[model samples]
Target: MTTMNKLNQVILSATLALAASGASAQMRIEISGVGSNQIPVAVAGFADENIAPQQISAIIKADLERSGAFKLIDAGVITSMSNIDYGTWKAKGADALVVGTVAKSAAGDYEVRYKLFDTVKQSELSQLNVSRAPQFTRLTAHNIADDVYLKLTGIRGAFSTRIAYVKEYDKRHYELLVADADGDGEQMALRSNEPIISPSWSPDGTKVAYVSFEQKKPVVYVQNLITRARTVIANEKGSNSSPVWAQTGNKLAVSLSKDGHTQIYTVNADGGNLKRVSNSAGIDSEANFAPDGSIYFMSDRSGGPQIYRMNGDGGEAKRVTFTGNYNISPRVSADGKTLAYISRRDGNYQLYVMDLASGQEQRLSDSTDDQYPSFAPNGKYIMYATQAGGRKSLAVVSVDGRVKQRLTTQAGNIKEPTWGPFMQ
Candidate 1:
């Protein structure tokens, strides 16, 4: 009995004016950029007792090469630092060289120090200092890698976030899955027979609010990982789906048909008296709360589904999209600077992002049937559902249309990947 809607206009506004001027357009390093420049580079492990220098070397080598900024030299081909010949690398067209060492502290922490050298200038490019516990070596490697990329290119790395998505094992069963930002470390929670949809994280990242059909009705439930306890937030007789948590953590904005029609409504996190936000009577669902409390939602009152925004109290709703015939599943970015949605192009649907300030729209993702694009807490990456070869799965892409990585272990299909609020 979970709120049932085959397809409702879920906040697919192509508004949000994105500024053309990039703050770091002339920057050096990047979180995601090309791995094609192929700057020939050589790196060797420094002496270490706590762990193998070779292990840390592998991490740095992979990260640099992944950036497409450098051509990583094979470990076997690396020359000794005693040789001290920059010409060998320079002659081999090496742009830079990296050398590092690892040490274990008495307290059991591993410390790694690395230096990036400019082969052409015969000078040091950057120095990175990193420390991590023995059990957290991978995290340390990620940080070290970020240090190197930032020192060289100047963009912050996003290797520490998580993506939440719905994975269907069968037509009647689905589970919410959490994976690494790169789609690693996947874990499942809350399995059910009816359709599960719209997993939204709290701003603090501790708990999650999603719609599940365990009771044979679409009901919004807020689940806490730390406690392994869940309380029903919305379980109306009709469709009660798409639960979005408000900024205060004590409230939620959700779509309900309890009043005989679907519209945006607000309720306490524990599920009580619903404060209806939209009363158009058309189809106002998928309410996403921006930072300032302005609710962004999808409504077809204008005849076709379009994006609209209004205050939390439900006054002065403004239309945001005038370009597409069909736009739905609008997700406002963490910073409320961008809106991501599934827009129909030609005959297929693709993910699109619009700057709320400028109303400029940019098409992203190549998946023909993509849906439910949500932003990470940092507003850098987006995860959504995509169909390929008639099979459904989850995928993520950068907002700029540069980097993309697909994540799923779906036995059947996957949908609605959302970045939970940052875990405090």
Candidate 2:
């Protein structure tokens, strides 16, 4: 069996944590494949960027390219908007254009401005201007990329969002890291000699609830990103694992083996008001919340593990997935219309997305050992972890399976990626 199979078989097991440590280097991305129909766009180098701390246009270009939504046409430092030849760009096969300027203000801040143009129509589409400290140059570039993405695709860009995953150096060394969507700007949230898994972000993107093995057993904890303070949410006897935040952010759904068999339960964020939600005799773990207050999870009550759903208060339990004999890790999209999960097919575990209303499903990944699927805030993509050649890394695939990207680190193995919501 593959590592994913082993992990899923013990999905309800307890998992890691030590004291916080310094941040690590960013994860390097190797994006491959592209959408069948990509928008052709051009981003020119920002004027006066030589004095800035970071190159704004280059960052924007990389962000857009990694998204697999745009085909970047090199503009080669055409920094002046007045010099943009729409006709020339159109003839060069660029349907859209982006040009910008960066300058240091007298008050010691960076002023950034960018404009989007429709080369086909020879008209300006939209523009934005912002001022930020030198340290936020990369963030400013990401914001501009988000604006451009929203303007062109009608979908909110997740470039400004964050993701959390566990990096495993060995059985005795692990770290929970939070980083930007592109995998840069990494900050260590927790580190330990034991293992950590199931890092879930709060709806507001302020706190993360994860299962740690600090006490030599599985326990759940919530950590504040700002102050680095944390509170134990669940350390009940037996295994405590897989904590997912509710939409309100005050409660979480977790799987605990404190009872006879591993089952699902809802607990207050403070680790109070623990309420059992799943009454299955078989293992009922990996509970995830839908937007409508329904809980979707995995259970083996029917003789095999399959996806099931119940009301928020654990009423009227019903099975949701039938085609697959083994389905774990059900991740509902923000809109509650789609579900992403891992399924075993022909002895290989792959990522799959299902339409809640239509009962139709499509496989999204081509890898053999994919696990822990997490949806982007926009629901346009799903990020998951897959292992190949004995090495584990993170991968993202468009909902339609047209685009794919691979993210790897300089050292260690990364897994259990949880994409964060749009920051407030």
Candidate 1: worst-modelled 10 consecutive residues by lDDT: 8-17
**Candidate 1: residue 29 Cα off by (Å):** 22
Model 1 quality (TM-score): 0.76
Quantify all predictions' global Cα lDDT against the true fold.
0.69, 0.86
Q: Which lDDT value does model 1 have at 344? A: 85
What is the C-alpha lDDT profile of model 2 across 1-424, one tens digit per residue?
0011122112111111111346667788888889778899988898898889988898999999988899999888876876668898998889999998888999889888888999998898888777766766777788788888998899988887779899999667999987778988776788899899999999877788999988899999999775568999999989999999999898999999997799999999999999998897799999999999999999999998899999988976899999968998999999999999999999899999999999999998888999999999999999999998889999998998988899988789999999988865
- Residue by residue across 6-71, what tens digits does model 1's lDDT show? 110010010001111111111012244544344567666555622643376665665565445566
> In model 1, which regions exceed 4 Å deviation?
1-135, 148-155, 408-410, 421-424
Clashing pairs in 2: 14-218, 15-212, 15-213, 16-212, 16-213
Best by TM-score: 2
TM-score per prediction, in order, is 0.76, 0.93
lDDT of 1: 0.69
Evaluate residue 421 in candidate 2 and report its C-alpha lDDT on the 0 to 100 scale: 86
